[model samples]
Target chain A: MADVNRGSRPLSPHLQVYRLQIPMTTSILARITGNGLIVGSLVFVWWLVAAAAGPDYYAFVNGIVTSWLGLLVLAGSLWALWYHSLAGLRHLLWDSGHGLELATAERLGLAVVIGSVAATVVTLALLAWA
Target chain B: MEHLTDRKRAEGRGSARSGTLHHIAMMISAGALVILVPLFLIVVVPVIGAAHAEVAAHFARPFPALVAALTIVVAMHHFRGGVEMMIQDYWQGMTRKLAILAMILLSYGTAAAGLYAIARLAL
Candidate 1:
């Protein structure tokens, strides 16, 4: 006799392992921003190549970076850059045997987020208001 | 319960050969970046929306040009190490090896490109 129905197979899904928290979310965001910077750096290569290529090409590449969508992306990438760098600093602190306490760890996580925004804003001000 | 002996553990020192090297290299680059990145932005942001000639001249200066060069080089190294870890986390098998190779090429290629452009501008 052929078995028509198999008994319910066990399904293990991993989504519920940890309740959402700032440190966890920020850690994931750090990974995201770290990779985001890689992609953004590729564009830096293009811009540099275009700069060396000539004036016409420079203008062409410049147009893209200065455009509205490009501006948004540039701003976001700037934020990511600051965020990623700050997160790396936090890691370095952890490596040096600092910020191991739970309260300090959470504070450092929050500082990364706040500091990134501040850095981005200051940069934009320097760029625009200078 | 059986546990590994201290002699056995001590014998396996640096079996991977790259033990702590990756961590140390990455941390070194990160430390350099902590300074270079801010200096780069300070030297760079003012010239962003300016004309091409203006931007070129700004980088032609020794200070800005040197800062930019160091930042690009160190940043690419950091970027490679970070991205490699992230990629390894998501992919495995042949794809992982291939992706890591591609990332290395991309990082160095980009670094070279930026350096060349800065050289062209400065010289």
Candidate 2:
């Protein structure tokens, strides 16, 4: 006879039991970056709204955003945006029935991380020059 | 033992039968973002530390204003869906419902505010 309380059974091993790998790290990064982008989005929106509000308010917000701490946050957000975008592209590839093999998947994961960093650097450099 | 086909067993069960819709929504937004995001970056990045007037004048251009508006709408919609899935995975009961509600509101509110601001700049 099946136990009526089978619903209470313990679930399988979770994060604590697993060894981290490139794919796992990249997947976790996808979520982190995706959620993390809200900060940058909020700040950018505030800047826009403030600009629309008045020059004083816009100056205040702009001053803060141009500060060192704010620049750090912006840099982090830039990297996160790039990482999430690339990871999303990787997912689209998987959805199309490719890159499922272990080696290819891992390689793609590595590419996402490295590519995002490179993209961020190039963006920042271009922004500086412009 | 109760008998049912595998397909029959799979039917009518899963996140209120909207899993595919959610996935398609994410994919569509992702596709849109692939285009809009880079365009937005190109539009906004140059004026990051520019003076108030310059920043406003920059966004006032048709290209920049349009790109920013579209990116805000689509990205927020995508964010809402992604956060809903995250909440579903980690939360339950009323907390999950409330969290989802909060995220949805946040996403739309951000989008509305952003669009309004852009509209002001463009005008």
Candidate 3:
């Protein structure tokens, strides 16, 4: 009924066979965080719809979005936004015939992680101050 | 090593017409987002935790409204092109069709709703 034995075939190199590197991991994470960003965009939609609906509706929606859970989603979203944007920049560099070197690629990958974290912190800190 | 003529190798590599197109579209959108996102963050961050009237007033201003609406719409376009490549890489046949359609609709729906809200706020 099912080809349960397909796993035994000599397939391409699988994950278990070797070590993973930063660039490799970041590349995969880019797609994941992209999806996360999409979900986060819905928060904005909720805000807009509530605002149009009226002040009471806006407050209700805004209250939920500002709660601890909402903050977490916002934080995740901020990081996703930063990370994806930077990674996309890296891809653009590649498209333009730069950052093709292995060392530079790995460095770019690390920058995505660090840059996103920094941007999120700065944005949140500014929000706190404002 | 396998023997190959230049023409044979070129033909074997397969059609890349759509691949280049996708790459260019994605890059253009990425270029726009690189500017729009930061501008949007700058605009929105100042108004965080603000009162409803204040928030509405902030968005009603042309600069924030325009930056945000463009960012949302362009970002969706970029997302669609990029995510479709990922989906195609792992999916095929019916699954690919369904997944691509679902993603496109989500992106398009988001873009439309977002623009409508911005239009209401701005106008």
Which prediction has the highest TM-score against the true structure? 2
User: Using alpha carbons, what is the TM-score of model 1?
Assistant: 0.86
Which tens-of-lDDT digit does each residue in B14-112 have in candidate 3? 765788888788878888988898998888656645678987888889998888789889988888887798898889889999999999999989889
lDDT of 2 by residue, A73-93 (tens): 999999999999999999999
For model 2, the stretches where C-alpha displacement exceeds 4 angstroms are: A1-3, B1-14
TM-score of each: 0.86, 0.92, 0.87
**lDDT for every model?**
0.84, 0.91, 0.82
Off by over 4 Å in 3: A1-9, B1-16
Worst 10 residues of 3 chain B by lDDT: B1-10
For each candidate, the DockQ is 0.29, 0.45, 0.28
The fraction of reference interface contacts (C-alpha pairs within 8 A across chains A and B) present in each candidate is 0.55, 0.56, 0.40
Error at A125, model 1, angstroms: 2.1
Q: Rank the candidates by lDDT, best first.
A: 2, 1, 3
On residues A31-92, what C-alpha lDDT tens digit does candidate 1 reach at each position? 89988887677676677667767789999988997889778877888899999989988989
Chain A, candidate 2, TM-score of 0.94
Fill in the DockQ of model 1.
Answer: 0.29
Number of the top-ranking candidate, with DockQ as the measure: 2
Q: Write the per-residue lDDT of candidate 1 for residues B1-123, one digit (tens) a residue.
A: 135555554675535767489889999999999999889778865565567888788877899889888988999998899888888778988999999999999898889998998899888
